[model samples]
Target: MTLLDVTGLTVTGRHLIVDGVDLAVSAGETVGLVGESGSGKSLTARAVAGLLPKGLTATGSVTLSGLELLGARERVLRSVRGARVALLMQDPFAMLNPLCTAGVHIAESLPRSPRPPSPFPPTDPGASPFGTVPADPGASPALPQGSGAAPTRWTRATRRAEVLRRLAEVGIDDPSVADRYPFQLSGGMRQRVALAAALARDPELLIADEPTTALDATTQHEILMLLRNVQRARGMGVLLITHDLRVAFELCDRVAVMYAGRLVESGPGFDMAKVPAHPYTAGLLAALPSATVTLSRLEGIPGGVPAAGDVTGTCAFAARCGQADSECTQERPPLREIAPDRHTACLYEVRPRPRAEPRAVTPREASADETLLRIEGLRKRYGGHVALGGVSLRVGRGESVGVVGESGSGKTTLARCVLGLVTPDEGRIELAGLDLTRRARGGGQAHRLVQCVFQDPTTSLNPSLTVGSTLAEAAAQGTPEGRLSVAELLDLVGLPASYAARRPRALSGGQRQRVAIARALAVRPALLICDEPVASLDVSVQAHVLELLRTIGRELGTSLLFITHDLAVVRQITDRTVVLFRGDVVEEGETARILDAPAHDYTRRLLASVPPTP
Candidate 1:
């Protein structure tokens, strides 16, 4: 049965942001809505759940289990939310209350009086209705003649037990976690708590919006497996919204591609991966960096997605599409069935391109005498927790070295120590034979020797400043010969010189990251440290950023310390790889050697955790 049926869904605010989109999810099915940022995937999911932001009006048919929900009353929608449907956002922190403990959050989601059906059914007939063994296995037997008092419909003891049960179901085995606040938990732990809360109400339809975007590969795989298991056990329908095609293919039964507010393609995950029918879908797949295959360059989509109201009578993607012509620009193609159980909105049929042979990357060996940055016996401690323990690495001039590790594995901590943001408990950092450790302690001139590019450009770049102003500020601090005009800086990063006048808010995610790179380049630092620089970007944009970093190293002769959890990205950009596990360097060798034949068990586990290339 169709659990969620959306037909002709149109969402309008100042303009038609989400145009006519039709999607469906069946019971026990997982449907993936895949798209880049600002592609209307989230808005469509919100509209289906009647949770659109103010000023955005949704007009269409939204049926949840045969009940219309688009124009439903607020009371009706309120009743439907949590009880019949649940939404899991990208950031669990945003959904969880800081003041509430984990137990409180889950308990609040539970219905009072008559309880809903348990999310999991009992395997044994004699088990409790809540899908657990009896709370007291050794309790005395009931009285033979009329018990003194029958149990109430719902009790405090039962509610507490249910909350703990839910937490355990989501893989939180420790009961003490229920009393901890959101801030006390790790990123993975907090996400599990949020999942427990979402299932507390026994929702039939769950909409997970990028739930594992910020997690490490292992944690992401764990969450995906947990979600799949819960969905299968309860027969719940899932609408997973994500930009990662690999992730979508890993767990989704059906995959739907959305582009510029429209459903461009829909098909089975296997078929879509093997042969994409739409040009845009193929473009996204081609842009992805591979964990197993090596490419000289990623074919990133040339241009950004068109803003709403930019495309009127033509296809929204035609401007960036390589296959587009005058006909594509003149006519908008409606989504139609192109093959059995497959649909596409392209005018011409697109078949799978021939697989390119993996290119052999020649590793750049840095001689010992030419090293630009070197660390010896690096260590950091926060109370009893050790962040980095005797970790040592070196980066040669113009060489790109990658640090791959999960969260809390000393990647960011190491970067911070190099950036002088943290004073290491013990270590020696040398830049160009200068004692960076002493410089950091003495407030010396290390800023001119090194610079950084953070993960989220939105937070790194000041929102109030225009692109030109931010670049100018960084330029002023650099050597006189290194300073360049704002326009020159913009051009160097492949952005139009005209973009100098725009602010960070005015640019797309890719554009803002370009501006960030331009600012970093303005300093003309000898060493560049990037911490998860492209983690949040879509595939094409991420490819563009990675390529830009490579170009900067090649053309400008700047050494790079690239820190990220994505092994595919490391394979594409780094010459050498260092694998960190729990504050220790478990492996370090040539990028190709480590990726092809990992020596350490932790390194092998990290490689195994990555979703297979679709």
Candidate 2:
């Protein structure tokens, strides 16, 4: 029996992180952990790996074949940790040893000892007590086709071969990817390496925490598929913990909704996504740009997470759940099966649930005559290949425009050209009627008319500067003191005057992002070119940021060229949208018209990939 049983798992700490939770995973099963930020998804993963941060304490039984996690010695768990159950953490750049070759990391995760089990338990893939397997194969070995991963095809040469295979599976076209170091590879390549290293061990269960949050759209899709492939081929149990349901919908078979360190509901991923039994889960799904009922319409569970003391009695979510009543605050809901395959944690009735958010809205159309910024015959060939092939497009003044495509599709090349960061080898960028190329050698308003918001907020913000100072840096070519004094700019982004004191490390992902936006606006550029702005944020947070960007464009006379692969986001905020396929503008039109009635086949396929809204 190779099932993992986590019963009455109450993980707590000096800070009261996760309280009560129960979960199980059998060989070939994949359990998704979904939640908002600060919900303790990562914390739970760390506890399982015996790598919990300081000040944390766990009191529960996490057993695999009768071995207790909390009761076992660290050394004993260490032996089985990587060899039996592995961890695929978020941010591979920091997880992978920077100095070592990617190959070495894969090799190092291999089993330390090959000795057979001294006293193996009555071995059976079926008839597991944790409900991972059935007693009879004739009765169906397990769930359906995606019930769980099938048995693995692993061998001695599996590490190297699997590494290459997983890389290819994750969409690494170049075979040399296996030989590159973590630093030498692009973000997507590095992520593939991390996946390879995690799967190289051929463990029974794999824990992945927000694996695709850092990747671009095409890369994110590729990575998601790679995980599914690994699960299918190995039939290994997978615990995918993440804040994004869109991710879970793509690969997970089932999902667990967590909040303030508690598992409130769990069931089939598609079912939960389609008909969330819990209000918190429903709100999460509602906040997705794709799930918003209509443009500029959204519903987020109000109030940030309550502190430990503020959530003592009854349901932790009652404070934020709109359906909460006195009974909700007075009694804690139990995890009970509400239907054939669904479980929810709510005492109050969730009568016939509302319709899920729509997957893709009709995109609005872009005006052909109202071209605010136009790129004509853009060409930036790096020695041999063309990065952008005479790319041309237009953005209406004070309008939001979305540009999406695969990696190296000239998305960044085009964005950089617009920002004047990358000088095009050939082309003319006409912004506000002034040609960018004509003024390359002299100071002019055209040069200062556009700004960029990068993908990685960490690298984009200075480590030493406070959020206030970071935002202040955007002032147009003036000394720190001469610019929009830190205070004014901080307030511009809805940040408090006090935020001027907190450094980047002291802030959250959403806050840091606001700081980045604040910095860009400091220059008072006529055009704001944002590149994958909300890719790393949670759904609720993404809704807020995208709305904020759209709001800023409307309130301030700032025209925006918003770039992202999330079609849902484009549908919500953009007045006009452009679909880029392999460095080519395949579709361009009004947001509502294009989003609702996508004409291009690639755009339609992209729309179809999004999860159905409830």
Candidate 3:
């Protein structure tokens, strides 16, 4: 039975965003909507629930369990929202109330008793097609049994017990977690609490949008597994939205590809992974870094997703597709059945091309004489916590080294110490044989020798300053002989020289990151520290940025101290790997050796947490 049916769904604000999209989710099935940012995946899901933003309007049919939802009254929509459907957003912390306890959040969604009857009738006597609340246990022992009045099913005791039960269902076994506030929980714990709240109402359909995007590898894997288990146990339908093809293939039974606000392809997940029928699908898979293999370059799709209403009478992906020709630009191709249980929107046949064979490239070796930055017995302490404990590392001229660890593992602390953002309690940091530790404390000239690219470009790059102004400011502190002009720096990062006039807000996430890289290079530092720079970017955009960094290292002889939790990226771009666990260096070796046969238990656990390559 179809749980959700959306046909001819069109969302419009000032212009069309989602155009004529058709989607469906059947009972007990998991469907994935995979696409890049601004591809309308979230908007489509929102449209299905009549939850479009203030200015936007949705038209056409959106039915849930045979009831039309589009243009429905607010009261009608409210009645079905939590009882029939639930939405899980990307940021659990933002979704949760800081003032509310975990138990309070879940209890709010439970059905209240002694209330007016529902306007909508139940589908059946014992159950409802949407969702049926479980039979409540009898009233607490304190209630009088001899009273003539009926015992209330939704008593305070029952609600508290239900909250605990919901939390346990999502893998939160500890009962004390219910009393904790959102800030007291870790990222994984917060997400689990959010999931428990979503399931509190016993909705038949769940829409999860990028739920694990911000989590670490192990936490992400755990959340995915938990979602799968809960879905199976309840036999509920799911519509999961994400940019990761690997995740989609791992958890979804059927996958749909969306681009430029339209559905480009739909098919079985495993079949699409093995033999993609659409160019966009193939490009996404090609852009993913392999957890087990290293490649010189990832084939990232060129150009970005077209803005809504930008493409007319032509294929939306023609500008970026390698195989597009004049015919592809002449008319928009309609999605049509291409094979058994497969559909594609491409005008031409998509043949399965063999992937590039893995080639072994020798890892770069750093000689003692060529060492650019050296740290000896670095230690940092904050109150009762130790951020870094005697962590020592070296970066040679033109060498790229990866620091891999989960959150709270001292990776960022180490980077901050080197960048002079945080003064270490004890250590000797040397750059070009100069005493960096003293320079950092005294505000000396060590800034000229090193630069950094942070994880979030939006926060790092000043929104008020244009790209040109930001670059020019950095160039002022650089060596006069090697300083790059604004236009030159923009060109080096593959952005147009004209982009120098634009501010960070006007550019896309990828474009803003490119500008950030350009600003970092404007100073022409000998060593660069990147702390999870591509963690929030789309896979294709991440590939482009990683390749750009590699090019800079090879051509400019700039040393790179890359820090991230993603081991796959480390394997693709770094020469050596350092594994940090709880402020301690657990392992250090060649990238290939560490990834292939990790010596430390923590390193092995990190590798095991990575999603399998599709």
Candidate 4:
């Protein structure tokens, strides 16, 4: 039986968006909706769920289990939403209620059942209602108790039992974790909690939107495996909406490639690698680092996705496609059946281009004795948890070093320590032969010696300020001798001088990241510390950013401390690799050696987590 059937689905407000989209998901099937940002993948999902943003109207058929859902009333849709279909949003943190405990999040979604009273009801006035006494004098109570509290519909004991069961299903084995808040858990754990909450609804069809975007490589692998297991056990249909092709290729049974709000091509997941039928699909595959045998310039599709109402009669992707001709631009191509299970919308059948042979990056010759930055015996503790324990590394002048680790592996903490944002419990940091052990906390010359580029450029770049103002301010703060002009800084990052007048909102994600890089370079610091800088960017954009970092290290002779969970990216960009497992340096060596033949088991696991090309 068809779990979901969306035909001629169009979302329109003042402009025509998500035009003529057709998709389906059958029982026990996982269908992937893959595309670049602003490609209407999420919009299609929202159209089916009746969750389109304000002013946007969804037209055509969106039926689930033989029932039409597109034009259903809010009350009618509400009944089907949690019971028949559940949505797992992109950001787990945004989905969670900061005020609620982990248990309540799952418990509230469960079906009605006869429940028992609290197992350990509070008898003492000063004790926690959940049966724990406060250890600190001024500690806030875990569960606040009151004299005449209004009764809830569900029993505490039953809710707690259901919560524990749901948590276990998502791999959180500890029942004690029920009392913890979302903020207390790591990124992976929080995502698991969100999954548990979604599973609580016991829906036949589930929609997961960019579920692993914020997670580490290992954690992402775990989550994908968990999703597969969940689907197998429950025989549930999944409609996965994401930009990450690897995640979709790994989990989904069928893949649909969307561009400019239209389904361009679709086929069985495995066939996507061996036989892609659209130029856009082939381009997306080639853009992946895994697709190449060696580091080469990623042939990113030129030009951005056209805005709604931007393109008229022509094929939406013709503007960016290299094979486009006058016919392609004059007539829109219908989604035509190419094979028994494959379909594509194009003027010509495209195939995956042959990758170039492996070519190793020649090691740059630099002075081995010239150390730009050095760390000795670094130790950092957060109360009882040791974030970093006895870590040591060094970056020579003009060298790029990669710090590889999963979440909670002390990568961010180490970056903070080096940047003087956090004082390490014990460590000696030497920059340019100057020991910044004690004076780092004061934010003097030590702070100016190193500059950082953060992960989310949306958060890092000032939304209110124009690109020109942001770079100009950074340049103003630089040393008089080293200061750069706004135009020069933009040129250094390969951004046009015209972008100076525009704000971050006007730029694409890749452009925003470039502006961030430009701002970082304005100060002309000796050392650059990038913390997951390309984590949120598209694969093509990520390739460009990595190239920019490499160019900076070579042309500018600046030392780079690149921190990321992406081992493939590390291999391409950095000369040396430092593997961190639970705050300890498990392995340190040349990038190629560590990746190709890892000495530590943890390092091997991290590398293995990287999804294979196919």
Please name the candidate that would achieve the greatest TM-score relative to the true structure: 1
Tens-digit lDDT track of model 2 for 1-614: 44678776656665677776788877777789988788878878877777787777787778876677776797898877877788877789988998888767765764542222112122143322122222222122211134344334335554454444434434454657666788787776788778767765567788998887776665677567667655665677899998878788667877888887788899898787766788888778767665223554544445566544446567888877777788887766778888886888888565432433544443333466666688888888877768887788887777778887666677888888776778888878888777776546345466467778887688899999877666655574543443576787777676788988999987777778888988887767778998998887778777767767867887886888988877777777777788877667888887766767889998777776565544
RMSD of 3: 5.1
Candidate 1: misplaced stretches above 4 Å? Answer: 114-154, 351-357, 439-444
Candidate 4 residue lDDT tens string, 1-614: 78899999988988888888899999889999998898888888888888899999999899999999988889989988877899998789999998888898887777664223222221231321122222221111212234423234556654565577667667776888888998999888889899888877678899999999988998999888777767765678999988888888888999999988788899998988678889888877766775224465544566678864676577888888878889997877999998888999987877456553466765543464787888999999999999999999989888888999999999999998888778899989888877777653445466567899999999999899999999999898788898899999999988889999999999999889989988888888889999999888877677678778878888998889999998877877788889999999999988887887888989888877888865
lDDT of 1 by residue, 1-614 (tens): 99999999999999888888999999999999998898999999999889999999999899998999999999999999999999999999999999999999998987764343443543231321223323221121211123334234556676666777777667676789999999999898899899989987789999999999999998888788878877876789999999999999999999999988889999999999988999899989988899987787777888888755677578888888777889998877889998887999889878554444578888778899999999999999999999999999999988999999998899999999998888899989998878878543434357878899999999999999999899999899887877788998998899988888899999999899889988988978899899999999999999899989989899999899999999999988899999999999999989999999999999998998899987
Off by over 4 Å in 4: 114-155, 291-293, 354-357, 362-368, 440-444
Pairs that clash in candidate 1: none
Scored against the true structure, residue 158 in model 1 reaches a CA lDDT of: 67
Cα-lDDT of candidate 1: 0.86
Model 2 residue 531 CA deviation (Å) reads 1.0
Per-candidate Cα lDDT values, in order, are 0.86, 0.71, 0.85, 0.81
Clashes of 3: 0
Worst 10 residues of 3 by lDDT: 114-123
Full-model lDDT, candidate 2: 0.71
- Root-mean-square deviation of every model: 3.9, 7.4, 5.1, 7.8
